[model samples]
Target: MTSLDDLPIRDDLRGLTPYGAPQLDVPVRLNVNENAYRVPEAVALDIVQQLARALPDANRYPDREFDALRAAFAGYLGHGLQSAQIWAGNGSNEVLQHVLQAFGGPGRSLLSFTPTYSMYPLLAQGVGMRWVPVPRADDFTLTPQAVREAIAEHDPDVVFLCSPNNPTGTAIDLETIEAAAEAARGIVLVDEAYAEFAHDRSRTALTLLERHPRLLVSRTMSKAFAFAGIRVGYLAADPAVIDALRLVRLPYHLSALTQAAAVAALRHSDAMLSRVDELRTQRDRIVDELTALGYRPYPSDANFVLVGGIDDPRATFEALLERGILVRDVGLPHTLRITAGTAAETTALLSAMAALRAE
Candidate 1:
């Protein structure tokens, strides 16, 4: 067998691991921050019908511009957005890659707060750009003063901010976003993958787009819409930003099926997002119950909670697995991050933790 070391891989990627979480066959899975609810049958049926219609046109390529899909996304986002301001890809990861390709490259750098979306640095490196991570506050928060200082020191070509940030699920204040835009002499990209789960959905970077021509906001259909398997992500920016992405994007990158699925899903957006409120309730319950159990869970605006105070995260992770539940050990000291699952699943997670403490 040819080992990776024996093959001619890039030196920069030699020791780095691909991004992923455990995909075990456990009864209760709270890892990966995916929406725990299944798509409603009515919405699923509608999507199947749309796919069926798109199959006949498979021989020909999809709408290269995906104009209809873009329009749908603009309608869904509704911060006075229009189709010209929207751009999409197979997933938000691809959308972010497009930004890096267009705005960042060799000799340039990508800067973001530490412990953000794990993929940010990897995406930067893949494009031959330098990745600069500035640590967040001790409580895993970022303030305006901190944002200004980091940008001034790094002077990077691209700044990535993950709101309702991953791992800790801490959201960035608008003031901090404003600070980054004002201080940086480059593109400001806000990865709002979890924005729908935030307590105040209106508090988004989309609100800042009119003021900051360089600001970019990315979103996905995976979480709130429970369309993860479909792989649809999009961006809203000044139309000029969308034009720049077009220069770097492959012709017809989004397949006909993906466009159909996403469009169909958005048509019934209300049904697709019906479970969001319930998921929010479960997330809050996790925080409260964990606190009562004497564990420390960070304040979360996303659909997950990052709990600390573990004697050994790996030990507790394995113990939870043994009890037929699964969570994430997100490489933070004495901490575990768990997705907000269904009510029954949340009960199982809490019950298992309580039992572990009793023992």
Candidate 2:
């Protein structure tokens, strides 16, 4: 029998684990930070209709540029961005990979504050780029002064900043983003997958693009749009940055079905997103309930809460699973992440936590 060690693999990947959250068959699943609601029936039907239209033309290749989808993406970002300033891929992961492929390479480096999206370092490693992890403040927040110092120290070719950061749900202010950009000599990528769930659009990095051409912002339909199955993530940047990404992407990478499905979803973007306010309400409920349970909940602008004060996060996670609820144990000591799901799901989680704490 052959083994992985027997074959020549990239040395950087030899002992590294792939990124994944548990996919358990529990009743109240909040892991993976997915939009817990199904796409509205009318929108689902519209998606089907769009996909149906594309099926007949499956023999032909998809539009190489995905022009209409790009336009839809631009309209959604809405910082006066032109379609030329946007690019997308299967998911934000692939979109980030494209950025790395274009601007990051063997001799170059990618830098990000720690406790970020777990995939950041792996993406850099995959492309033979150095990954520099700068620790954030104890509260999981970054100060502009701290950001400036790190950029000056690492001098990386690419920098990643995540607002409403994963696992912690802390947002970065525009001032800090601007400071980081000013101190960096290379590309600054702001991952805003959770932006739509934020309190207001004023906090978004999109507003800084005209003044900072080296700064880029990436967004996803997976979260707010309930389009995780669609695998669509897009970015807004200078047209030249979009051009750089184009050079490295595979020909006709997006399938016709994907483009059509995304178009259909965006066509009713407002109606599709009508549930966001309700979900935001539930997210706040979780924060309050968790704090009331004697846990410390981070200030979250995203659809989930990163809770501390658990005696043992892994044990608490399993106990909740046994009680027919599931949440993410995001590898942080004594902490867990629970997605702000539907009203019912939120109730179930709160009830479960209350019961567990009493035991």
Candidate 3:
């Protein structure tokens, strides 16, 4: 019999490694950009209470339309419910997959900037779409001219921009997004996964909905809202674009329990806001300390900082691991991306760094 592994895979997916976050038993878990905190006890109890109220209906399938949860999400964002401008998926990552399904396929292409959220290319490959990347400037900023040129040259079906980008943690400006939207013949997706931690007000891209029918802005509750494990993400776009997403998404994509949890989380927005403030403060403290140690840390508006040019980043990573402190060593040589942990965890990292440097 022929071996299953001998069967031909999609050419685009032939050599791809499965994507995942690191798993290490460490005291300071700073590798993934998790909220670095837990849901408050009060919020946890309220979620339990809400779910208890729905226990009898637990046997029933979740709402296929997910209307109530969608409305709550839009209301939390201060957008109108009747506008048909929003969507939700298991995670923003899934939302990305749906976007690819809607606009990209075997013969089409997906475009994105490099050193961005790594998932973009993977998602494109999974859909059997061609993936194209344009490199950012050394400082990780996108130029309108370069973007316009790429749009004109490649004419891709989809483009993804991760603002306050992953790995680098630097944000692209509104002008860049708008210019990309104008120049592109296809969809322009702005992944604002870290927008809440940034200083700039969210551009929403909803504001440009009327002008750019193909624009979509994706957001996640995983980071600032401390809901990573619960898995909720949303998109804001023109009604037409959202309709396209709705067509491709799985029915009841948002579970009843998840909907309840997200609603409760949104209801306590004030408390979540407070946590964001605290995390931002901690992130700044980490940046200051790392810079004082002579490491070049990128100016970040997100919950993590990307510091590069360390000597032997792998050795540094290993040393930190030995001390029960975990941080991410991105593929770049001598560079590490550190997520902000609690004050105590941050102190542990600093201590580990000091010990490593002294050696």
Candidate 4:
């Protein structure tokens, strides 16, 4: 009569708490950095129409290979089938887990920068791979020297670099990524979940796929394409790497609804880009306002801004929440990250902050 807890589990996950975004139902929700707008009515109708037409076969399993969706995704990215390697999963998170399964193991290591996406370390732990982090410079830039040193020292099997990094919103330069790719002995994974919001062009790690067979560029429809709920994320890498992921991935990992929704979303890409531009403008305005308030907002190339050295970020976060504004308190003691919402939501957030300051 052994209790469930009495059984031995993977030692690595013994004391781990699950990772999650904050759950609050505040008026101006901004905790998760979601695109602050909903899919346009036309796009929504298009998706509904597509799904309605395809529901007869919805009872059947999705295409195991996801060939059509993959081709659509590659076409959207302007990459051909051979040079256009892709793999789909429930989310980019799943794609990342597959990456760990394929490359990282008990003896291997996963490398990344500190105060970046929190998922990298968690994913490494989940896969029983050692997690190694190198602190970024105070400015949140990855110096080539630091990356070289880390690669030489830990020699990780998988490296996760989040551009326009989550929580920090600072993007790594192409030179830094190139140096890291050159230095790594194993796979270099560039997580570009927030790339669309950035002013800089997406560093084409895809171009480097052939030369650096170890490089993988992971992307998601969640952020820019407004498809978070649909959960369609894909990875682009060398054909060999893509094939490896396909082998390790669960069959029919993406649902028919997800595929249909994703394809529809891509069809409405221009409309989505217009929304992204609006959000970027709102983000810039928020940053300027924060800076004028005497708070140092980190230079952001993403949908959110990270403000540090505040008096009490948690208190500030709570205060904002009390005022019906939701922002993320990243547990950095005196740092808070705020996502840019629509123009109206952004105005409300700033007004709430100003009122709180007056108090």
Prediction-by-prediction clash tally: 0, 0, 0, 0
Q: After superposition, how far is residue 200 of candidate 2 from its true place, in Å?
A: 1.9
How would you encode candidate 1's per-residue C-alpha lDDT over 1-359 as one tens digit per residue?
Answer: 99988989988989888888889998999998889999998989998999999999899999999999999999999989999999999889999999999999999999999888899988999999999999998899999999999998989999999998998999999999999999999999999999988899889999999999999999998999997888899999999999999999999999999999999989988775669888999999999999999999999999999999898999999999999999999899999999999999999999999999888
How does residue 278 of candidate 4 score in lDDT? 95
- Better candidate by lDDT, 2 or 3: 2
- Could you give candidate 2's per-residue lDDT for residues 214-247 as a string of tens digits? 9999999999899888899999999999999999
Clashes of 1: 0
Off by over 4 Å in 3: 1-11, 79-83, 202-206
Stretches of candidate 4 off by over 4 Å are 1-8, 79-84, 202-204
Per-model lDDT: 0.93, 0.91, 0.84, 0.84
lDDT of 1: 0.93
Q: Residue-wise lDDT of candidate 4 within 168-273, one digit each (tens)? A: 9988887878888999989999888888898865555555666677888888898898888888888888888987887688878888888888887888888998
Which 10-residue span in candidate 4 carries the lowest summed lDDT?
75-84
Residue 220's lDDT in candidate 2: 91
